[model samples]
Target: MAKGMMIVDGQRVNFDGEKNVLSVIRKAGIEMPTFCYYSDLSVYGACRMCVVEDEKTGKIDASCSMEPRDGMRISTNSARLLKHRRVILELLLASHNCNCTTCEKSGHCRLQELAQQFGVRRIRFPDTREHYEIDSSSPAVLRDPNKCILCGDCVRVCEEMQGMGILNFAYRGSNLQVMPAFDRKLAETKCVSCGQCAAVCTTGAITVKNQIGEAWRAIHDPSKRVVIQIAPAVRVAVGEAFGFPAGENVLDRLVTALKLMGVDEVYDTTFGADFTTIAESEEFLERLKNGGPFPMFTSCCPAWVKYLENENPKYLKNISTCKSPMEMVGAIFRDKYAAKDAVDGRTTYHIAIMPCTAKKMEAARPEFIHDGRPDVDLVLTTHEVIDMMQETGIQLGELELESPDLPFGLGSGAAVIYGTSGGVAEAVVRHCLPDKSKNALREISILGLRGDAPIKEASVTIGDTELKLAVVNGLANAKKLLKEIDEGKKFYHLIEVMTCQGGCVGGAGQPYGLKKSKEKRGDGLHLSDNAAMFKRAERNPVVAQMMAEYGEERCHELLHVSYTNK
Candidate 1:
């Protein structure tokens, strides 16, 4: 062992002034178990699963919150520590309802994995935990307190990251539980249903509502023609759910899988994003000229839309009137395809494969409903789509690749970047530029808008129009930016706000626990964009042809929708 290195289990590891022993051990390839220790959040040392012993001091402390010292000999798995962890698992298991087969997070639960890691045969502690009824009132998220491990992951994420305190510790002592104010139903509270709580949940305590059964029913129905639109982020994230690593673009395989699953028609939501870019860019240009609003906010993110509607209704008019890509595509499906395919609009079912749980709520929005049927009949998250593929025995890795159906299939590269935070603004700038200007396209590509930064701002001139653009992800960042706008400290002609961290790539419905998955997914989208034939939305032949066939005014009427302050 070296003099400056710390020894753990007879292995000398480099110490790089890591704030906690857990990080040092992890850096040395040691897997320490933890429930309450999130890398981005404040450490609370509640679980004590990572407790390590100092051989010299004869003391055990939580490795997550404990600072590492040079030449410290820490035993990560002493006999006493093993016994302590086993008992802790037993206590957690005793309180938790052991209905693993039907649980939404059965295979993915961290607590279950830890229990298996500790090799627990049975629980010694009696089941004294109080049971609570499951709350399925929210269209996007479901809450089952019986499965909660009291990790406070949901609580911290909601407050610290989102700036929305929808979930918190309620009651006192033994009766303590997580709930909205006054223990109100999640649907009744100020919950925007961003599903970050569900994303951070280690168990099925919170999860996106499963709509796979509805999709199956729609497909099985003889009268209904089931059509699906796949979102941009899903292509990158869905592969990870299977055997493939993160950021693998399996769009062609996904299309093949959908065809095998009896999906009647497959379309790309990026086609609709092309429509959005055209309409939203025109609207922004008009607003900029007429001074409709200083900063016209992008309305592609449904969760961000809901947040503005609920928390800041004053800016509702400032949001773009363009419907989200999914909804816009649904409108096109219902209006054009029904007559073309000789099927009644009532019998045609539209399903959206999205990377967001909030899209479920957005699909169910009253504004999107017409003739007593929703524009999108069902919303399947990336997780649910993977489950569907597995259930149907479709081998995604081995399947022969297939292209999406025509008309709404080929999307421009501008549409491809919509999955990340700064992507929307960059896409808009690209669309605004003329196709012959290769210099403008190159400039747009490197315009310092795309990154993991919470907020990014850039000023660029496209086609004689000097545009001020701001791109923001995470509602907390959006809130701060909005405050700056209110104070007149920040000024912009256009702003793109995504509710999640890295836009749709970091969506709540993505697969859990993939390191740097969002960045990889974003990179995948960029790679896909580089390979694409069309770079600008204005140059997309299908969208341009559609606009020519059906006048832009009529297309706006059909594809665009309104917002409400509910």
Candidate 2:
């Protein structure tokens, strides 16, 4: 009942309503090492690295799970605590496959960093671990159990955040390992390839599938005309990999780098977003007019789309049929854009640089291919784009910024904001609303359908009807919304769902440990949206020209695709 205060290392610190002693210590600007602790997930208290000495009680407690009480005295880093941490790291390393030199997470592995920090020079225990085969069955993610420390971050994130318990602890004690149910391969499970597991994993236990070699192969082929499109989120987050601050836009520099890497032309996915918006807005308007399937879910997020198919098949009819911006651009490049530029589509290698790992799976979908050739030949994550740029030996900061190529390069403000959670709903209202007045699109923002909230709702007047819209991020949030919709407790004319928390900006393939990166990256998109020449997708001259040239029927043929019920 009294004001909670803690003495951390002789300094009087206020708990400030933090749930645990670890939170209080962290809030006081003291670094307490942790392995199984994630701010968003439930505390396991399995990692003893955060064990702190309670001077008042003369007891050691895992700070992550310990309650901060009034006048509690805590020693964060004592002699005994350091020795215990060192021993814990040593024991974890004894069985860990120490292939840091070749490990995918070599530079960013938390276990390796903690071991180095704790001065773990040698392991007293013998290396008795057996060979565990890598699980690279999923096209978007790879699982290497040898690198796992049983911290349970991946298992917790997959189950808690994604609502898909694809990864879990299996077996018992020394023989225990995290795996899919029945220890089946990841590809054989209900996993939707969102890659949140890889994003949360502290070690190389999980990682995005490395396709840098495949990209290089296409680049090296002289006969191939390589064209790369940069996604909306990539421009803001990719700069972080090069020591730049989060949400730093390096679009021009990115284009320059791709050009130097033998890319024939660099395009912006925002252009595709423009087309997708036009098509999707039309679809939403049509559905609204029909008065059926009241809440049409946004299908731009491939992971969310796949989740609908796999888990909520009855709602398949509720999902928008329009392909994502990535696929829309890929379809255009493979069918019409290449022909307009006098390049054979067959010889052109279309690569999409994206934020989400699920995009890799999306690009490989048979529905998006024609004549056995994928519309998008390769998919590269934000990290992959940075790695490829680094390999070129070009300093991104030193290079001059270059604009994207014409026709497929220009986009509206509505298109660029598609990178974040509520962005799709905002773009739809901006573009689809019948009113074209300058102040009409501004109403969407005034309705407060933007920000970092897990869920957002707004009402807009279209013609004589008022439509309610909801935007939700994180699959867990989406699951809760779906339950409400199914039970008739909540209803909306439109709902936008992004699988990852904070949408694509917080994707699994983003740079590691960039805290608050999603909020910052999303801010960049909003700034771009405000500064864009045209606020609505319909105002884009390029989109108008495309519509005039392709007509409504053909435009749908190129930018739209149907989903399959699993």
Candidate 3:
């Protein structure tokens, strides 16, 4: 597309390769209100909040669906456009469940924000919509049909971005609603519990299930020892709820807040990520020696694991048996605390604070439970932890920095970067390489592993052979790659697949953000990696000591797991 000029609200705006007028208008510094206009998704044009009027002819249309051309003139904030937006809001509110104060997405809901911005003080129509029962069948996500505005954001994200058409519009005309086929519960379908639907939902219609109450009860129990592990991505993204910059690392402050809130001990999940990197690298090397299962897929992401079990079970043997970092640490803590319980007479309640909603589902997997007790007692999202901090009257920004607990808290730089896409592959490469010098680490970092691209491919020479590697984020991209691999069009020695775009940094349970914010979060992880004392997982002394203490057989029993097809 050629560069063009247009007038948005009387200001001349230049557009170069912008897809829609809304992009050009936003580029012109105009804040256009929208409900269903997501940059990464297809244009629905269902919500007329971004309607603009043509200056030459008194006609109005959605800016998202219209392409910008040379010599185009439009009024974005005319009285007519405002009235149109207000009317649309009013109609939406008429049927919507308006209990904003009790909603999970209260302060962050787009519908509530736009309602106040457009002065939608009242609804003119009757609430004739039927009250639907809330669906809490999924362990990760909650669905409330009453609060839906029929924006189709969730539908498109699940289909286009995730390659999972678990959600779609049903019925006709005024009775249309988004739901699974035949209105099946999310868990009953092939839903991977990624929570991408909840992430894109503009209202409280869909949300992460609240586990804050469960977390609080465990914290308040004097008979229990509450130990929490914060995932690598949580540190960078959790601060967003408390007015911190998008990519700011608030781990130290978060550690202080968790301790102040009565947590017995807080550790970094990266410590476990180090173990994963080492174990996975060993597994890859063994497979390379055997010369079979050509590409061993990573098993860190629960959503990706579930997708394989549900949709592509034939390739289950190719997935590495290494437990996820969360589960690996949880199992170690469970064993550690079981001994402490025998001596101290206090039950240990292990909690995992993670950026992925699927972690909640992952924790509840049957394999992670032993003797009727779960390894991780509870799983909380980044948002839930922020909410808990706010409820306890602890402001993250106001809190002073404090170090994480020793031993299990210290993680290598390779482990810290596990929060983003390709970080796992890069970390494993760092472990595989014989050279441990800074230059070798720098060379490994530039292996096309770090970026916002959905799928990244690279190669590295190890010993006598060059190993082909691929890192993919987003299930849709992974699905495409899988198809190519199945057709013999693509081959790799090792593959890393993260179900969410940009890896856990762009997880649905993190602060609701698009591509740019996710990039900032990824950058924060890299910065932390750059400042670490050790660049490779194999260099982490704590991990090395733990491996020695646990021994080979015990380590294999605890750190590895096999999945059953659902």
Candidate topping lDDT: 3
Writing each residue's lDDT as its tens digit, candidate 2 over 349-464 gives: 89999998999999999999898999999999988888888877878888888999886888888888898878888888887777777777676777877876878888888888
Clash pairs for candidate 2: 252-402
Predict model 3's lDDT versus the native.
0.93
lDDT against true structure, model 2? 0.87
Candidate 1, residues 354-467, lDDT tens digits: the string is 999899999988888888888898999999988888898887999998999997898988898898878888888887765557777787777889987988988987567788
Q: Give each model a TM-score.
A: 0.96, 0.97, 0.99
Off by over 4 Å in 1: 1-5, 340-346, 463-465
Query: Which sequence of candidate numbers ranks them by lDDT, best first?
Result: 3, 1, 2
lDDT of each: 0.88, 0.87, 0.93
Query: For residue 140, what is the lDDT in candidate 3?
Result: 98
Give a tens-digit lDDT track for model 3, residues 1-566.
Answer: 74889998889999999999999999999889988999988999988889899999989999999989899999999898888989888889999999999999999999999999988887888988988889999999999999999999999999999999999999998889889999899989999999999999999999999999999999999999999899999999999988998889999999999999999999999999999999999999999899968789999999999999999999899999999999999889987777889999999999999999999999999999998998998999999998998898888889899988987898999998899999999999999988888899889989898897988999999999999999999899999999999999999999999999899999989998888999999999999999998888888899999999999999999999998888
| TM-score of model 1 (CA atoms) | 0.96
Error of 1 at 185 (Å): 0.6
